[model samples]
Target: MKQLMDLANRDPLARRWAKNCAFDLMFGVGDDHYQVEVRGGQIEAMRERPSKLTSWDFAIAGPQSSWQAHWAPVPAPTFHDIIAMRTAGHITIEGELTGFFANILYVKRMLELPRIEGWLQ
Candidate 1:
């Protein structure tokens, strides 16, 4: 989670578009659960909770092992594509989809951050 925050903090694009947005991540694959919060493109908080009740303006869910694959650069699997996938049942989401497509470019730029290079691989 620190790594993700580091990436977001250093990302010019993330900083730009996250100006008024509050995003959260909730994931778990057994006894371990992790939650991360990002507001104004910076990490506001993080923690490991026994339950996954954390909320945010947006959220994505899936196995942690799928992170790299889901984030990998692909011609059709861009962040927008991910959102579509989630809506189509390829993945799962627990938030609003409105205006999500409008933020695709910003999302792409954030994914290009160097700190998150490993996740993209």
Candidate 2:
């Protein structure tokens, strides 16, 4: 996750997409879960367990495999696909959905960065 975040921070497209945006990432691992929130590219909050708060501007959640698969290819996965899967119970999210779909291309481009690919172990 640090590798991915580092790549995102250095990406021009990611920087543009993240400008003034708050993001939260939730991952499920067996009986335990973890969440991290980023505001203005810096970690604002992090926690375990679910909360009623929906303060983020965008949110993404999934198991490790699903999350990793999003960075597997040059184009990566689309927001539409991720949302669709979430809606179908394959993933889960809570927060504002606005602008997230619009920035899918930017997220994909960020995943395609050379530094990102190099850290894919």
Candidate 3:
């Protein structure tokens, strides 16, 4: 997913959406996890976390199957968006909500990069 985040850096909309926003987000795909640092609309880093205690502002976690479905070209209903996935129990979001909510749009757009890139297809 680091590649997906990297794609966001070149995306005009993603860059604009993230302008002036800085946050650290942890994305979990089953047992694997990644920490993505965004500063002033650029993704500074996205690396796998070796320990669970690694610091991050917020986290969005779900099983691999859930993520795969959500990344599908035409995602299944409820899997198309984060809130829908969370409400349907397909994913869980935790940690500091203030940062998450404040940059929710950016986060959402970041997550959709794979789909937008047609990488999954």
Candidate 4:
């Protein structure tokens, strides 16, 4: 995931897309969780969840299996999207939604970055 962020930080398109966005997104894969901090469209940090009381704009969590499928080169139906994963009960999204919605495109594109380089495969 750190690699993904690094690559994204160097991506011109990604930077442009998220230029005005800023937030901390908590992403969980099974028992592990990461806090991805974004400011001005650049991924400033990707690290383990800081603490229970750490403030985050929103969170996206799911089992390892769900994420594996979602990151597959050719994701199966419903596994191809975050909303679909939520609707399918494969993942849960919580916390403040305004930030998530406001930068929905960036969130989706950032999560899908792995697909571009086939990193998860």
When superposed on Cα atoms, how far off is each prediction in RMSD? 4.1, 4.9, 1.1, 1.2
- For model 2, where is the 10-residue window of minimal lDDT? 71-80
**What pairs collide in candidate 2?**
none
Q: Which should have the higher lDDT, number 2 or number 3?
A: 3
Colliding residue pairs in candidate 3: none
Residue 63 accuracy (lDDT) in model 4: 99
Query: Would you estimate the TM-scores of all the predictions?
Result: 0.62, 0.52, 0.94, 0.93
Question: What does the lDDT read for residue 47 in candidate 2?
Answer: 71
| Superior by lDDT: candidate 1 or candidate 3 | 3
Candidate 4 lDDT over residue span 20-60, tens digit each: 89999999999999999998888899988578887899999
Error of 1 at 100 (Å): 6.6
Which TM-score value belongs to model 2?
Answer: 0.52
Ranking by TM-score: 3, 4, 1, 2
Q: Which window of 10 residues has the lowest lDDT sum in candidate 1?
A: 107-116
lDDT of 2 by residue, 43-90 (tens): 455676767563445555566555545445442335225555566665
Per-residue C-alpha lDDT of model 3 across residues 1-121, encoded as one tens digit per residue: 7688779898888887898989998899999899988898898989886467779999999999998898899999999999999999999999999999999888999888887788789
How much is the lDDT of residue 72 in candidate 2?
A: 52
- lDDT top scorer: 3
- Please list the residue runs of candidate 4 whose C-alpha ends up more than 4 Å from where it truly belongs after superposition: none
Query: Which portions of model 2 miss their true places by more than 4 Å?
Result: 27-33, 41-59, 74-80, 95-121
Candidate 3 lDDT trough over 10 residues, lowest sum: 45-54
TM-score of 4: 0.93
